[model samples]
Target: MDLPAPLQWTEHVLFSLLLAVVVRSYVLYGLTGVLKDLVKFLRLLPGVDTLIQFILAREVQTFMNKVSATPVDSEPVKKAVEIPEKGCSAEELLQDMAELKALETVTEDGKVFAYVYTMEDEHAKTLRKAFDMFNDPTGYDGNDKPSARENVVNQFAHTFLHENALSPMVFPALRKMETEVISMVATMLNGDSRCSGSLTTGGTESILMAVKCYRDRARELMPHITEPEIVAPITIHPAFEKAAEYFNLTVCHAPLKPDFTVDLAAFEKLIGKNTVMLAASAPQYPYGIVDPIEDVGRLATKHNLPFHVDGCFGGFMLPWVEKLGYPVPPFDFRVQGVTSVSADVHKYGFGLKGSSVVVYKSSEIRRHQIFAYSSWPGGLFGSPGFSGTRPGANIAASWAALRSLGEDGYMQKAEQLMKTTLAMEEGVDSIQGLSIVGKPAMTAFAIMSTENSGIDILALADAMEARDWHMERQQLPNTLHCTIMPHHIGREMVFINDLTESADEVRGKASLSSKGTAGMYGMVAKIPDRAVVDEFILQFFDKAYKL
Candidate 1:
């Protein structure tokens, strides 16, 4: 029987898959879970022969936010019109904003997702005022001149209004403040003088810069390999996958064990000649279990690879947890093989959004992250980190926020957050059909249906959402995520009550699983082809901008 080229290729894939399965079941003599991880190393095309093996399994998908046909809080614009015929009065604009603000997702429940919600409204006021004053950069004909307003803003925020971080020579104050910020974060992470990094816009930018640094470094050292790869746990942040997609590298995901930590043996096996970098998460987002950083660090040392610990979720809070006497594993530059570490200052550091840091073990390695071009019309052009026209206001605001919290404030908040999280964990465990995922090492954890409980966790999320409690939905085991903040401290019982009611409401009603947000994620989870999944997400994005 004559077969098409694609079919023949599929045949080969299936044959290999079957042989691997037989070896695992018969020859291997143990449910090691390494075989599937080894199969993940293969970069197959068009997604055919392997379909049978993994049609029901989760695909290696990439997305900033999950696409839902029935998206939550996607309030449509009130009305569409051309550019206004006349400028509206300020009073009219404020009235319009007030009406819109009333429609916010958080109702009286106040269970909105701010795991470390602190000083948000206060910091937001400064940021808003700063952004408002800079409506048009050109409006500043006399903007450079100092005023009483300048002193007032500086006294509170230290913001360099209308300032650009394009060139530090032009804004020496920004350069100095940014230096001290980096140094402070490095010292907190237990790094010495050798530690170096840049304050990026956010955690994504920090991770992107780290990947770029190692990729470029490998280009110089290992030029023979055109396509480089990163070996990381499946639980690694999607930013790494995003980095790989942007930088033309592959992310080989290793499987997790029963506890949801990366299978270290499988992780080590994935490391080959082409592997340029290794990454582990400090309390990875889904499970909130810090991947075995010390073990991965040892692997990085043995393989002579640059390791990155993504502490974006835990970086700011871990030290406080450790000081509070929580047994946190050493996850910073203190580990021998940990070459770079990323932490989101915007998260637990109490900084406003658009602030994160990725520190390195040495200045030499950090140098590769910088981009420069001499032959240009603008003369020597250079950018460290992603943004060229970086906002000086963000740097100033972040600095102010950090200084305001100080060590004592953060520790106090950590104590509150830990107490709330543990309480929430116990409350969640008390639920009959639901369970918290993994041994949560920090503030975040996911709630999942217990095995054969017949509880659709996604349906439970919809039930919570309807109650005006902003919930986070997760997959790869179908769960809902929750992180306890200071605000959540007194409201554990409220959430627990809502959760218990939701569970009871959904019990024996399997039909609810095919409705609303649950239906969307459930449908997507079953698809094996990554291209199909990509297209499904693309349609959601396309529709968003269809107007």
Candidate 2:
């Protein structure tokens, strides 16, 4: 083996190279096998499917704890108990509710803004009696107590309760009420006699229905199109976004002009064959400025697309405001090419919650609002709106509220609300470093501070809250909002005094910290990444369910 030293050295070198290659290959194969085993072990872990759920639960629980720490009135949790020896009297339940109501600070004569639209004691008593008379359990059975159910309360209950609108044959009254409500809203909006529509749960549902209708209509007209879009002003309600998410539609938000009205030129450029609907708000929620619906309607007509007027906030009030001689523009079906409208009866309609109407120009258009499931075991179910079983009591209460507040009653209330709104607007405008947003003709208005005024709107909101005033803050321009009601008429001076004092105090502060929505909105605006903002919102919802 040691015959020649050089030959021996060369052979040794070759052997070392072979050994190195083998070691390297073995090392790589071991690493790859270990990784595969690790992945398999992870998959084999017991209840691994619940890993994501566990993480979500922990996150949600943490969020809830944070939310619970915030100072806000929360209802006590009432645990349901098995029937003890005997059931408690109904009177006891009523007493508990009364005590809870007494504890509530935002009742009538309280300085809370907009929530409780109180009337005279006499009127309240009348409404209470109406509710009691119609609150009988027999009210739900229409055929059994036809004559007793003839009144608005019983009739409304009979129309909605146990009577699934999903089955028109089983419940004809639901169909009638839905038709009548739509027709009445259409008439108020100045739609032609041929106009029609469906009843929805609220403003959001009505808006959703309209968007869905337009999306389907567009799909039918354009078979080759997979992506449908809607063009709306930036002021449009967020419900449109929700609709777009559910129906897989795109939204093009046009900016507002300097005066806060919709920029028609931007809107014109946004519309294309894929554009299904064009939306305009009658006194949008943020600035309370009515979009130029007439101009928007003209554009929609030119493009052969349906125009939707989102009057959910102002629909019930503006018609009466116009009758009272307030300067309100035509933002309803009166405008040609305006095909659909959403109006909430719960807000200005003074109806109980869970009632609103979405009206259309014709039966053909409204037919799209229907949801039919013929193949289901439930037997040819078809609901006009989203819900399966709606509370008849709400419908009855709405009917009662509407009938009680006839045209004359509405006119008087509208006058008072308009007067109070104008007074507040004027008072805020007079304050130093404050300016009204736009020419609002109804019960809502907003105020923004002058440039470099050092007045933080969120700080002012907190200050107002300290005085028991629940004024809301808006984003984008960063302003404070107020929706005046009839109850606010005599309290204008009190509000003005508080506003002036709050503005002066907040302006003097070195730093302002936001609370509630104001703080959330502030953070959202600063976040450059929209995904992070979405996460924040999702975390907020998770927080809402905390104990």
Candidate 3:
């Protein structure tokens, strides 16, 4: 059948070209469809426009503000300029800020379930007053001498500002406040006299500091090991992963059980020679189901490893949740092997956003978190974690919040929230195709769909959004997240009613169009290769920065 050899070769080449063309055409067509769908979906997202505006039009700070201004707020500069110029008047600045505020995504009065943690109006006013009073104290500075105008600033600074605590004699008042804050938190978490910790910027910093301490501890214990690993449940906060990335430690994530808590056996197995620390969230974020921390703690004790309990989301609430007669498990320092614990005063603690406490069982281990260097020209520099300047105002605010809330205040809030959570859970379960995601341990929970339900969970989320309920959409079995705050106390019926109506609307309309956010999420979930998803997110981040 071979005619001339050259002619046969040419025929083979032509067939190969034809096949390439056909594949290229098919790929192009598929890609075009995906692009269109993504575009449509992004446009339909509720806050995309507002988010873009917020990022672009927000006030930009200048270096002058950093070095000048004792309180920084008295003469605020709107933006950094390429060249020096006259600044806008106070009236002009106020008008401009109003414009930016106007761009905020307007939601139904009580429908927001994320980001803005609203307090009672009176409580919020109290925070505002506290913030205003000490808004500009420098934690990094001692300010031994002051001008007449700076006298008040120094008083507040002396009361709360001591990032390094160079000498207890120098700033005894500041040192005392910090000690009491840690002691109170440690006592709440079941730590005895051995417990010591630092007040950090927030949960992220607290976590970062904890990871660093553990990493350094691992280094001292096993100097020959080149790599250190942190083992945590898949549901642990991203901040832990951020710590791993920042500290050059590897993270081994243990998968979850059917109940959404860490698979204890599997988690224990993930621990290896390189494993330096273990962490588990108390009432993990997505489902709000607490891990078997006591079991995990036992493993830590067996392995002679440091364990950290992340109660950032629920730390302030769980103790109260247990007090309120819920079946709460042992998650705090009461667990035998827990060496460190992080709790944010901002979340359920109802403190300002930038405050959290990370406590260690002893100063011996806590010293690993301190950064000290004497060789540099800047005299014996010693700081904890990674900040040169801590925001003293946040510390002051957190102290105020804790003192304001007291034990009775927190329990009152927890009781109110738990009731609302139960109502929401009950309402979700009553829906034809919907169900609550786990035996949620605290006020946070998620809603998912039944296997036989024809309704798409994502589409249901979209429908709820249409009703002005900005529920947080989540994946790994797609669901909507809800964190019941004080403001959300009375809105359970509204949420349930809206959710029920939305489920009904989306039940049979899987192919109907309002599936923008859900559709994108579903498509992303199907892609087996995570690199493609990473690329998509990178592009999304790029677009976010574009004006």
Candidate 4:
């Protein structure tokens, strides 16, 4: 069987090549099998079992704890042995409401920041009168009166309440009010006549609507996209997180620069084929610093994704501020690529709570915001928002708030608010231990203590509370926050004086301790596992309803 030397060499080479192919194929197949098994094992772990359960548990626990720990409602009402068999008199109901109001803790005497947006007695009376005037009109129920069993205020209480918005003939007034509100807001935000929107319950609903609209639009335009995502700065409201959770969208949070503005490079890197929306805040909630919306708009244009400006906090402030000659950025439909915006009327709009608007640049895009069901026994039902039946009173109140505080009034209020805010900013900056977080061009601002100041901002907040001033404490960088309102204009000096004294007192303490919900927030910030924080939030909600 011996052959020539060349032929023998060729035969050997052929055998070696065959053996190499077999070995390589087996190695590749084994690696693939191992990877599949590893993925399956990871998926089976308890930690990854049910994300919904994990997330909801933490939120529920935190909520419960808050409800339970509220000290104002110490006496639980007991059931009566027999019914009165008749409705209570109006006077009796009024008396009961007054009693309940008296039981509420007065934390608004400058002791708390951002919650109440306290007003002077005269202003309070005015607001009350306005509220009473429309409380029964336009078919809206009272918010929290004397009775708990009354379903009159349960969103849809009037005869026209259950009428379907899907059919314009059934609830024409609802559609009209909704349209007018959107038009008014759009005009205020410098949108063209073509701009349109729908009324949402609040900022979160508005945000969710925008997300869903953009997601659907993207899918229609680009059929291959299977996974959609949103790119937002870390400072954007947590409502976006809720939207992502509910819509099965991935949220990529871009980092903030040292000054607390969105990092442009990081934002760009996070964009991919599946990114359907880009979000920027006009004065984000944490530090109240407006992002570079013009730049973000440009990025959105380049990426061909919808740009959403979340002006829930500053929607009413920015236009007036700009008119006041403050250095403001373009944050509305005027900016190209800014397709949608969410603004809350309850915040700065001075409307009663539970009203917000989400506007889009064009009615074409807004078509996606509508929800419809064609196959129900109740007939074809459709609504613009998540709720089945919304309160017409809120709509009416929103209209009244806007009409009452016309452009002139809003401008004046904005001016006063800016003055107060500037004064507070200067006061905080003058303090040895404190520094302003960012250049707050609007009414909202934050302050943090330096290491040299020997003051803990959280402790300072607690001390301020002792002085009957309520200021919010923020974590990420450990700061104190304030949102100046019309009522705070004249009281600026009082707040400054109290804050100065509080800082001094906090500085004297060798160690600081946070109590109550403030302590919970501090602890939640330090926890590395977000799941634990979620549980704490849930507990707070649960505690809120304890009787």
TM-score of 3: 0.71
lDDT of every model, 2 decimals? 0.76, 0.71, 0.73, 0.72
* Model 4, C-alpha of 340: deviation from truth (Å): 0.8
Q: What is the number of residue pairs that collide in model 4?
A: 40
State every prediction's TM-score relative to the real structure: 0.73, 0.70, 0.71, 0.70
lDDT of 4 by residue, 454-509 (tens): 77778788888888777787888888888887557577789889988888887856
TM-score (C-alpha) between model 4 and the true structure? 0.70
Sorting all predicted structures by lDDT, with the top scorer first, yields 1, 3, 4, 2
Better of 1 and 2 by TM-score: 1
Best of the two (1, 4) by TM-score = 1
lDDT of 3: 0.73
The C-alpha RMSD of each candidate to the native structure, in angstroms, is: 21.4, 21.2, 22.8, 19.2
Candidate 2 lDDT over residue span 1-547, tens digit each: 4649888898799677656655565577775655654544455557874785678667756754453312222332132111122222334433433442233232345554322354546776676567546453331121335232134443344333322343332333344345555665677777766776766789999999999888777766776768888999988999999999999998999998888888889989999877888998998988888888999989988988898999999998998899888788898988987998889977887655678878888867877777767689845556667676665445544544454445666676778777778888889989998899877768898889888788878778888898999878787888888888645768899999999999998885645645555565677789899898888779989999888
**Which regions of candidate 3 are displaced past 4 Å?**
1-172
Worst-scoring 10-residue span by lDDT in model 1: 60-69
lDDT tens string, model 1, 425-540? 99899999889888888888899999878789899999999999998998888888887665576788899899999999998799998999999988989899979999978998
Q: Which run of 10 residues does model 2 get worst, by summed lDDT?
A: 76-85
- Point to the candidate with the largest TM-score: 1
